[model samples]
Target chain A: MKILFLGFGNVARRLAAIVTDEGWPSRRGTFPVEVVGLFTASRGSLAGAVDLARARAELEATGRFDARHPLRTDMTPLEASRNLDYDVLVELSPLAIEARGEPAVSHIASALARGRHVVTANKGPVAFAYRKLAALAETQGVRFLFESSVMDGAPLFNMARVALRGCRVEAFAGILNGTTNAILCHMERGGSLEEGIAAAQAAGIAEADPSHDVDGWDGAAKTAALANVLMEADVTPFDVERRGIGSVSVGEVRRALAAGRRLKLVCRACRREGAIQTSVAVEEVAADDPFSLVDAYGAILRIETDLMHPLVLTQEGPEVMDTAYGVLNDLMEIAGTAERKGEEP
Target chain B: MKILFLGFGNVARRLAAIVTDEGWPSRRGTFPVEVVGLFTASRGSLAGAVDLARARAELEATGRFDARHPLRTDMTPLEASRNLDYDVLVELSPLAIEARGEPAVSHIASALARGRHVVTANKGPVAFAYRKLAALAETQGVRFLFESSVMDGAPLFNMARVALRGCRVEAFAGILNGTTNAILCHMERGGSLEEGIAAAQAAGIAEADPSHDVDGWDGAAKTAALANVLMEADVTPFDVERRGIGSVSVGEVRRALAAGRRLKLVCRACRREGAIQTSVAVEEVAADDPFSLVDAYGAILRIETDLMHPLVLTQEGPEVMDTAYGVLNDLMEIAGTAERKGEEP
Candidate 1:
């Protein structure tokens, strides 16, 4: 299948590598994936435009590539739509929430309008305009899958829709933001709030301007997407009550640890008397509990149901890669089925 | 949608109550499910037959019975097929493996042949003849879902197919047979092997014969289903190395517990050096490990993948209900999509 990748970030790079390596093992053995084109946010050349020349030189010394994937920087959505004959579009562009007229949203919307399936890691499009985008996909008979938008690649979307079938999900609670969770873990281990933030930054777990993750916006975005898409709840990011790890102090962390408890940034959404309420809070988890042992940026979803006991699902590690692969897998399933049906009758 | 039930067992009774009462809340809220017909093996009149009487009593006790949803007994497969006008068949008959050539298989085959989706809790047809049955369902363009055949209702089948998508499952290890797991849990708590077996019988966890579960054949059957259907590894029950929990002595259990370990009847299927091998054995799990905490009939599937970490999923109670619901859910998704498409151009 001919594929077009939008953006040249970490996820985009990994996807490019996986698709280009023919003999690489997929979960189903060595199936080859061909990447026909890549479009990045640059011009001149990634090698020429690199302000960090030393890092570029070190990367070039390895002989992998003198430059990154080719950047079609000047191509507009309309031009790309007419020019590219790709089967699917992989959208990995960095999110732009304030710019309601961003290129990523237009790119995705245009791709679906052209009846091309979209596999996206961008949460902004879905979180902001899910109903419009999903309805558009349905009308065009193409899939608009964004499995990575919620929990990286942990099957959180699939679990809600498929695994917990025939059961009403009353509540969904989890540790969503990895940066905050990492900082909280450090704080619980006797580090001051500032020290923990510094540790997270040093470990590359926190962004330079960490307001999105540390101030609970990231978790709220994920919660909105999950609730709206998976649970079919009418909600938005602004609807949730946001409380990040920024409120917790060194004294509070130490006191909790002394009481044999660990502080965890918890995100939860539930139907209360037919109204949906969501919040992110730092809760003290007991030592023997599973949440206490969730080390780093791990995520756990506790779903409350009526028929059976509460189902607790815990997923650990860097989930972005898994999420990317999940999006690819869904695309494969949808595309394979569609291709087969087109060939039949 | 009219549903035809093939048996009047506990599961069938529960499902009938849910359907007739329309009390079960779906994604669209409490929608009515009308049960048009029911069939049981009893020969007496519909009102007097033991199975029919029990079903009626249960439905009445739950206050879910309506005069519109009448009961029927002594209905042959052809008679019910012609009379009911049901869109789906719920097969909950007592599994008669000895009579492989009997009407249960033929009835199921005919139901699928006539384009009625089949949701079964019966293991007889699937364990012995999955290939033929699955091929028939494919030919008929309907689903043959038997989630309860393996783990009562704990999303085991769906988990393998959907949740763990895009990853090569290297191995599946679990305590599949609940009766044996219950026995082992009791034995680990200082009861003798015989005493534990007796307790299992008293608690209705084990059958009177108890050979199928305790002798490891039950777990072997479930392992075969998982391997064949989930992993797409063509395997039969006979291919598995069956070792029942009966082999584990009381002294061994005591010794294992003394060493801060608990004995569990473990069923494992893996691709070892490119060859699929499965077995049931007594493994000593560490006290602090998740496997050790699986008490009573609870089952856990530790799926090893090519990814960075293994996923451990535990289902705490009767798994058959979840499996049955999974089958129903799959049918709903497939059928719902088809119905919607049929409405379109």
Candidate 2:
């Protein structure tokens, strides 16, 4: 599988490292994944298959791609995408939620139009244009799989797609964002919301602009993505009834604890009156609720289905590796090389 | 798909009903599933194609199979199995945990030997002869799937098999038995162990002879099945370091609760040193543990891997429908009829 990466950032770099590392054992020998092209907005793009380790060393010491580097090209990601011979395109660009999944959507649409499979870690395209892209992929007979989009590569979507096939997802409630969860945890430890945000930043859970985490846009985006893809609701982040924990006080947190409940930034989605209702709010959950047991750095998604009882999935402290492995798993699936079965390592 | 059912009990009856009920809405269109044969130890046997709804009425009215019942057979399960024409064999007989999975194992082995796919709800085969059956299926180019064998169709094994492909399992700990959990829950409410057992039996959580559940044999079987299939451990239920909650006293439960911990029957497996180690025992879990939140009627499995963070799966109050759906889901996967993608309900 020849892969074209849209960004050369942390997740993408780790993906390349894992794919290229011979010491990393994949089941049933190895999958033939070659990095044929790479494009970065700041770092120069590579037009053809090249060794990433050599390129990384050059980029670190020389600070830029010039005549010294092989396969270096001046073409933009769009131009290089058409020129390069690749089987799948992996998108790992940073989230631009404010612009509603901008250039990423355009890039994916272009790739789909050209009849190429796509694997992405971007939430914008899924949150903003899931219906349009899914319909387009269906018309082309190729798939648009983003297993890492919503839950940091926890395999929630794939579980719904494969193992739980024929079962309709009726409703879901989850803690999708790690940032606000950390802030809530901080508040439970006697810190105010302001101090909580700072603590989250210090722990690298909150980004420089904490608005997305505190203002509920992150959770709203994830909710919209899940609702649109799994629930077939053509909704966007803007449609969510959003609230955040910005108003939470330390005293309120203590009171809830005394009452045997803990505050959480809960994301919920369900169909009501023939339409999907999406919301992200801070609520007091009982001690017995699975949502209350997820650690500050963890996440949990509880889904009700037509065929089974209430099913819940949880994850603890996902890092870049989780998201990177998710993208790699998607690539393997798109390449139809995901035949790891009937064995133990 | 023509299905040969080895037993016509509650689970098989529900499966037939769900498959034939026109009012039930399955995703996409209906899957063509026809009951071709059934062999019950006491409920009688039916061979060839059967309209289960009509056959069920006849069996209830007559209470025996004779010339009046179409396709009635005097052959044993093995004899009828050889004469039947079917694509897959489904085993839903009573658990023969004490007999090391008994006749169900023989029935499944016969089906696999003929190069046919097998989906079973029996744990004995998997716990006692997983390596042999799996090896046989591989050599015959057939699959032996038993998703309902553990966790009551929570999709744990399938999750490890499909969604987490290429990832290696490092360790797992779970509350896998509902009867023991229910008993412990009753004890938490100031009930004695004897009272707890009576309550479990009264609530239908325990069978007439609840030894398999209370004595930890059921969990041990599931543990061995998981270890044998997922971890490549060739151990049986008898090999598990097993203990039961029958020794748990009410005062001990109260003491654990006062220390902010809960008593649970935890089934665990890990590769220790150079071999797989399996255990099923009653232990105290912290209040914040995911196991602590699982309801008396619920179950949870936490898995650690080398590729990603700790992944957890949970289910609440599973019933006959959950196990029946599991069998149906396995049938769909085996028939190559699980092509559900790029769409919504």
Candidate 3:
């Protein structure tokens, strides 16, 4: 399998190192993956079968590329995706949630147009243009899998596809954003929101610019993506009734906790009269509710299905490696599908 | 898809009624299923495309069956499996944990030898001869799926296969038996074990003879099945270090509860020193542990994997319908495979 990575930031770099270390395809009987292209906005791009190990080393030694490295080019992700030779494209660009999924969307569209499968952790492309991208992938005979778009690789989409086979999901609620949840948890325990955000940022769980996390854009994007995937609703993040944890005061958090409730940034999507309705807001969850018990770094998705009633899937901790594993998961699934059809993986 | 029910017990009967009501193959775009045969230990056997609705009605009217029912004969499951024609055989016989999976093991072998796919709720066949039966099914080009053998329809095996993907599971701990967990939870709350058992029986959660559940045989069987499926171990119920909730005293439960810990019947299987070591026993779990929060009727499976860390799967309220749904889930999966292969389902 020939692969290319777009936006070689922390996620892409980690994924590349793991792929290189595990000898790509990792001896688990899947087809060997050869990274054919590497692209980034500022760190330079490489085309035509770049050395992944050397690229990873260069990134580790310095913030960007070692200029002397072979195959380094001044190309962007969109340009490389259009001109490069690859079978699968991994999109790891920073999410442009409010910009209607710009560079990542274009990168994905270009790859799909060229008959290549796309695996991504970027939420913008899915939250903004899921239907069109999905249609294009289906039309082009490729897979557009984004298991990390929601809940940081907890296998939510795969759960809907494989585990909940033939069962209809009536509703779903989750703590989609780890940063905001952490802040709220801290506030509930007598810390200020700023204190919690700083703690999370210092721990590398939150980004420097905490606007998206605090404003609930991350949760809204995830909710929209899930609504699109599970409920087949052509909804975007903008369509969701978005409310962030910023409005949740420390006093309110303390009051809720005293009243046997925990204030949480809950992302909920439910099917009402055959249409999907979604919201991302601060809700008071009872002490017994599973959502109330999830830690700041952990996530939990409660899906109400026709056959299984309410099925709870919880992840103990979320990490960057978890997001990278989601991409690998999608790749393995694509390979498994090919293998099932008796195709060379 | 022609399905044969080997044992017309609660699970089988519920499945048949659902199939009849929903007109089997219930939407999700798989092949339509027709119940071809129905056999029971004492209720007699019906051969050659049994009318599911009529059979359901007959079973509902009489606890067993009426002699006047058409095509009824005094035939055992093994005999029916051999003589009757079926595409899939559902092994819903009474679990013989102490018998080393007697009738179920033989019956499964008979069906697989005849090139019929097998879906079973009985844990015995898997606990005793999982590798052999799996090999037989693979050799015969059929699937031997037993999702209900562990945690009813909680998606344990499916989670391992689909969600875990190439990720290796290092260890797994679960409350596999609902009845014992219920008893333990009740004991923690100052109720007697007998009282808990009686309440469970009243709620149709326990069998009339609760020896199998209270003796830890059920948990041991499930542990062996999981060890076989997840670790690929050739182990049986006899191999596990088994201790039931019967020996747990009320004082012990109270003391644990007072110490911010809950006593649970935890079934653990782990890869220790390159060998699978498993045990089913009453253990004291901390209040913060997810396993401690699961209710008596609810079961929780915490799997430690290479990539996903400790992934927790909790199913609230294991019921007869839940087990029936597991059988349906497996059937749908088989049909999905056939559909993908473009075969007549």
> For residue B235, what is the lDDT in candidate 3?
94
Clashes of each: 11, 0, 0
lDDT of 3 by residue, B173-243 (tens): 99889898888888877899899899889988889999889989999999999889887889999999999
Could you estimate the TM-score for every candidate?
A: 0.81, 0.94, 0.96
Superposition-based RMSD of candidate 3 using all C-alpha atoms, in angstroms: 1.9
Off by over 4 Å in 3: A22-29, B22-26
lDDT per model, in order? 0.67, 0.82, 0.84
Measured as a fraction from 0 to 1, the native contacts recovered by model 3 come to: 0.54
The complex in candidate 1 yields a DockQ of: 0.28
Model 3 TM-score, all chains together = 0.96
RMSD per model, one decimal: 5.6, 3.3, 1.9
Write candidate 2's Cα lDDT for A1-345 as tens digits: 677889887788777777767765546334677778878888788877677776666666666666556798888888766667776778888678878898888888888877778889988899999999999888976668888887887988888775676777789999999989988888888888889888889987688989998999999989999999778899999999999887878899989988989999999999788888999999999887888887677888999888899999999889888988788777666655323322111
The full ranking of all candidates by TM-score, starting with the best, is 3, 2, 1
**In lDDT terms, how accurate is model 2?**
0.82
Question: DockQ for each of the predicted structures, in order?
Answer: 0.28, 0.65, 0.61
Which residue pairs in candidate 2 collide? Answer: none
Can you give the lDDT of residue B334 in candidate 1? 51
